[model samples]
Target chain A: AQSVTQLDSQVPVFEEAPVELRCNYSSSVSVYLFWYVQYPNQGLQLLLKYLSGSTLVKGINGFEAEFNKSQTSFHLRKPSVHISDTAEYFCAVTDRSNTGKLIFGQGTTLQVKP
Target chain B: DTAVSQTPKYLVTQMGNDKSIKCEQNLGHDTMYWYKQDSKKFLKIMFSYNNKELIINETVPNRFSPKSPDKAHLNLHINSLELGDSAVYFCASSQGAGGSLDTQYFGPGTRLTVL
Candidate 1:
């Protein structure tokens, strides 16, 4: 079993400001990590994923996440944010169980203000 | 063309009533999943099917039954809905299981309101 913990429940920032959403996971085995974004009333959209290899993973909408194995963290970052970036972000994890089931975090609400 | 679609984007029903939500995926994926998002926006997996076979049921109540007639279509039938069931239901699909790292595409989601 795996669990994801998002340290920040809400992040408020002005437009064009840099931001980081922290995520930590606890799993017995190796895992695959993912970040998803959801608009006001829309479903989730894939932001980025970390399968293997490199530690730095870049995603859409100028978002990037670094997978630190030693720290058991996959923190999402954006150099600059826009007002349109106001949304909910979720961090998920899954292992090689081949079940295709993902354990999601509590979610972090990013409020980009002007 | 929608990759993954769900019917009845919003469902409003009374308690003890039976209702069903339909989901379909045209991405030719082998795996389909159902997730529930609560009022606080907590997303949790409810069920998963692979090629018309039940693969995972995450301690959900038996009242929530999922039927997969084919690889592309998966329907959820809830018997005796409750107020706690008032949440957004999302349908998603993936190419395969874990280790593949295939992204799961999601539908628009069906908001069910049980009164």
Candidate 2:
């Protein structure tokens, strides 16, 4: 079994400000981690993923995340965010043997203000 | 081209009525899933299918059912719809990669309202 926990429910930041969305997980077996973004009235889009070999992973829209195995965390970060970057973000994980089913977190909403 | 698509973007129906939401993926992926997002914004997995095989069936009520005629289509049918069934349903698909590690593309969600 695998479960994900995104620490913050909402985050408010100004344009060009650095932002970080914290995520942690607990799983009994080898798992894959993913970050997804959903704009208002839109479906989710993949932001980043942690599969193997690399702790640091870069994604679209200048966003990036680091997969920390020892800490069991995959935190997303961006140095400078744009107004269009405001959206809901989700963290998900699933055990490989579980037939590709994902266990998602509660999700974090990023409110980028001008 | 749209990778994933769902029909009937909005649906409003009375209790006891039956409704279905259609979903399709053009990415040639072999895995498909149905997820529900509640009013409070919590997303939960309802079902998962791969190559027309039922894979993961969550603790969801039996009223909610998913049917996949082929790898490119996964449709959901709800019977005896109740007020509690009102929520945004999202359909997603991904490549049949081991460990469920592939990137999934999602459809614009169907906002179902059970009145």
Candidate 3:
């Protein structure tokens, strides 16, 4: 079984400020990592993912994540954030198996303040 | 066109009632999934089906049954729903189970409120 841990439950930042949402995973077999975002009263949308061939993966809305295998971390970062970026962020991991099932973290709420 | 669509965007019913949620994906994907978002906003995979075959069935209660008549549609039927069953249910689909990576596109989700 695979599990993900998001260290931050909530993150507050002003507009245009840099931010980082930490995520870690524990799995015996190989795994794929992903980050998803959900606005108020909406379904989840994929932010970025780390499959292979690249340590840094860029996603929509200027968001990116770095896959650190040694540290078992896939932290999401944004150089600058806008007010519209305020939403709930989730970190998820799926085993190398083709089950298409994912285990998600508790989620982190990013509140971009004015 | 919508990649994935779920009916009854919001469902509110008393406890012990029976209800169903319909979902369809026009993406022609072979795999579809159902995920639940609880009050804490934690998303958990409840079921996964491929080509009308059950693949992943989590520890969800038997009252929450999922039926797939075809590859493009997956419907969830809840018998005697409980208060704990109140949550946002999302339907998602991907090209295949083991593509380069499983990138699933999700529907807007149907919120269920049990009173």
Candidate 4:
């Protein structure tokens, strides 16, 4: 069974400040990693994903993530954030078996303050 | 157009009552899934259907039943709902199953409250 753990439950930052959301996963087999953001009362939107090639993957809204095979981590980072970036972020993983069932982390609430 | 959509964005009902949530995808995806998000914001897969065929069925209670009328629609019917069943249910769809890296598009989610 594969699982994901988000190191932080909440992260607070000021506008224009950089932010990083840590994620770690445990899987014996190959896996795909993804980051999703859910705003207030809205469906989740894909932030980024790492399928193959290039440890550094860039995503929408100027967000990016690095897939560290050795560390088994896919951390999301943004050079600067805005108040609109405040939302619940989730890290998810799915094994290569093709079940397409995502194992998600507990989610980290990103609070951006002015 | 909405890639994925769920009906009855909010549902509040009394315990022991039965309710159903409907999901549809306009993306022409072959696989659809149901996920439950608890109060604490933890999400887990409940069931999956591919081309109207059941595939992944998690260890959810038997009271929770899923029906797929076609490749584009999947509906969940809950029987004798409990307070524990009060959570946000999400519907998702993907291109294919097994080794497909296609991103699963999610619905806005149906918030169910059991009184």
Q: lDDT scores for all predictions?
A: 0.94, 0.91, 0.92, 0.94
- Flag the better candidate by TM-score, 1 or 4: 4
Chain A TM-score for candidate 2 is 0.97
Best by TM-score: 4
Model 3 ranges with Cα > 4 A deviation:
B98-100
* Per-residue C-alpha lDDT of model 1 across residues B73-94, encoded as one tens digit per residue: 9999999999999999999999
iRMSD (1 decimal) for each model: 1.8, 1.9, 1.8, 1.5
Please tell me the TM-score of chain B in candidate 1 relative to the true structure's chain B.
Answer: 0.96
Instruction: Please tell me which model should have the higher DockQ, number 1 or number 4.
Output: 4
User: In angstroms, how far off is B26's CA in candidate 2?
Assistant: 1.2
For candidate 4, lDDT tens digit of each residue in A1-114? Answer: 789999999999999999999999999998999999999998888999999999999999999999999999999999999999999999999987767888999999999999
TM-score of chain A, all candidates: 0.99, 0.97, 0.99, 0.98
Better of 2 and 4 by DockQ: 4
Candidate 2 regions exceeding 4 Å error are B97-99
Docking class of 4: medium
The CAPRI-style docking tier of model 3 reads medium
Q: Give the Å error, residue A3, model 3.
A: 0.9
Q: Over the stretch A33-87, how does candidate 3's per-residue lDDT look in tens digits?
A: 9999999877789999988888999999999999999999999999999999999
Q: Select the stronger candidate by lDDT from 1 and 3.
A: 1
